[model samples]
Target: MNSITVLGSGWLGFPLAQLLSKEFSIKLSTTSSSKFENLKDENIIPFIVDINNLNGDIDKFLSSDILIINIPSKNIDGFKELIKHILNSNIKKIVFISSISVLKDETTPLLEIENLFKKTNLEITILRFAGLIGYGRNPAKFFPNGKVVKDADTPVNMIHRDDCINIIQKVVKQDIFNETFNCVAPSHPTKKEFYTYCAKVSGLPVPTFDSSKNESNKKTVKSDLLVSKLNYTFIHEDLMKIVF
Candidate 1:
């Protein structure tokens, strides 16, 4: 069996590691030793990887057939360092789980990062994901207690944890490489609509916002290529309806 190493096993990696266990020799790395037992009980090899500062030497770890990077870092400079180290490895395929936030009000960063991966010799699949909701890290936490945006009608994008794992699995099986895909559900609920749903279920008051005053513009990433290229299906189509 091929080996798969997940760099992080927090809210997202927890489920991903579990899913990969059946098919691959899975190793999960985390900054916290407290979750070590949880990883061990799941029959996964766990490591304490302090890569948050982008200092994790991944050379030895890249011996695996597949590497799934799921760490959280908004600084492109840090990510650039990690990639600089990783691109030199003998690993054949790498899946970088990036965020749609990379696309939020900033094109240059994603563009530069995408260019770095695209221009590399390694087969890189960059998955720009939407707001991850469901389970521990819920979206409701951000828009808490009577919070509202002026452009409440602005489109809100979200994806469930299951869909994220499913998409990654499909790519692994298909050997899809050197491509970037969006991993978001098709639902484009307005900010008001989404917050209202959250408020109702999360017991928070949904405050009013003059949506016309909202000037923020962002396009929710679609999974069309993901569906066509990898033959993947989303567990949650209308993500907004499913999050709460």
Candidate 2:
């Protein structure tokens, strides 16, 4: 069986590792030791890894056939150090979990970190995800209580957590690497329409947005490349159908 090491087994990482465990040997990492037994219960090899002050045996983590990096950090300098360390590893295939926020703003700090990998020869697959919603995360919480959220007419670009895992699984199985793909739902709903509905369902104060705002310059992120290239179907294509 192919061995896969998942760095940063948190929200998305934990479920992802669980799903992939049936098909591949799983190695999961956490910053806290408290989560070790939980990971172990799932039949996953658990390790304590702190990228900020990495003191663990990195060689053992990179010993797998592939590495899926799900850690989130804004410290560019610290990421540069991690990049340098990873470049020295024997691991060749890497699946980097990034966000689509980099698309709207190229100056996003994560983009700077991602660029460092572009300089390397490793097979890198960068997944730029949209606003992640599912499970513990609810978009209603972001709108706050009766606060005016700008871009009311601007279409919301969001992706479900299930889709995120499915895309990664497809990427690994198909051997697709060295590319950046926007991972989001195809349908785009205006913020006012989407959030108002979300607030009602969650019993939160509905957010207000200017109805007169012009949406001519608004850009809806296109996430068709992955579906087109990999022929993978999104489980939650319509955000309205999602149950919180």
Candidate 3:
């Protein structure tokens, strides 16, 4: 078992900390000073530290065998300094919790970071996730109008809370070096199609399709490799009906 450190102990980080601590030594870090007690109660070693405010304590944090970067893209700039600092530490492996948004319509900085990790001693694993829909964390919040994007035919990719943690557990055990996997549900449903389903299920009004430019383009995510290799099955593949 490795000494694991999760950098951002938020929603997904808490679960990952719990998952990893069962088999490894865990040190979960977060910006929240108040949450560390809960983490300690959960049997996780909690460190209330912010990467942005670090003054060399990063070296202390990277003292683990594996460093899991759970901070979001808004803090991606910190990653540049983080990778540099990790090289100076005892850590040998890294797992970055990135998002499937990188695969969207724009060029992303992840590819560059992926290349940076590849050149180092740090054996890195990148988990690119899709729409994360858990209890209070709902994607429906983004589409509050009970309407999805214009491309009604565009498929929606999602993975449940339990499945994400489970897959991360499995992937770490493999000791695979420098692997990037898209973490998403196996099912893909059209945008409008799924939205209407959710609206009906949630007892909300079925939004009128405006036939606007957005209503016509298809956006999909690919994760065939994750499913075939890990045998990952999603608990909530289609939330449009169940979540509402």
| Top model number, TM-score | 2
Could you give candidate 1's per-residue lDDT for residues 59-160 as a string of tens digits?
A: 665557778888775456766776777767656678888877766656656556666666767888999888888887656667555555667777887888
**Residues 96-144 of candidate 3: C-alpha lDDT, one tens digit per residue:** 7778876763457765666667778678888888877665764444566
Ordered by lDDT, highest first, the candidates read 2, 1, 3
Q: Model 3 lDDT vs. the true structure?
A: 0.72
Model-by-model lDDT, in order?
0.75, 0.85, 0.72
Better of 2 and 3 by TM-score: 2
Q: How displaced is residue 143 in candidate 1, in Å? A: 2.0
**lDDT of each residue in 1-244, candidate 2, tens digit only:** 3889899888899999999998998888888888865444455888888778776576677678788999987777766776676777767888999998887678888898788878888899999999999898999888665678887888889999999999999999999999899999988898988888888888888887876766563778988789888997889999887888
Count of residue pairs whose backbone atoms collide, per candidate = 3, 0, 6
Most accurate candidate by lDDT: 2
lDDT at 54 for candidate 1? 41
Off by over 4 Å in 3: 40-42, 75-77, 145-148, 213-217, 238-244
In the predicted model 3, the residue pairs found to clash are 150-214, 150-215, 150-216, 151-214, 151-215, 151-216
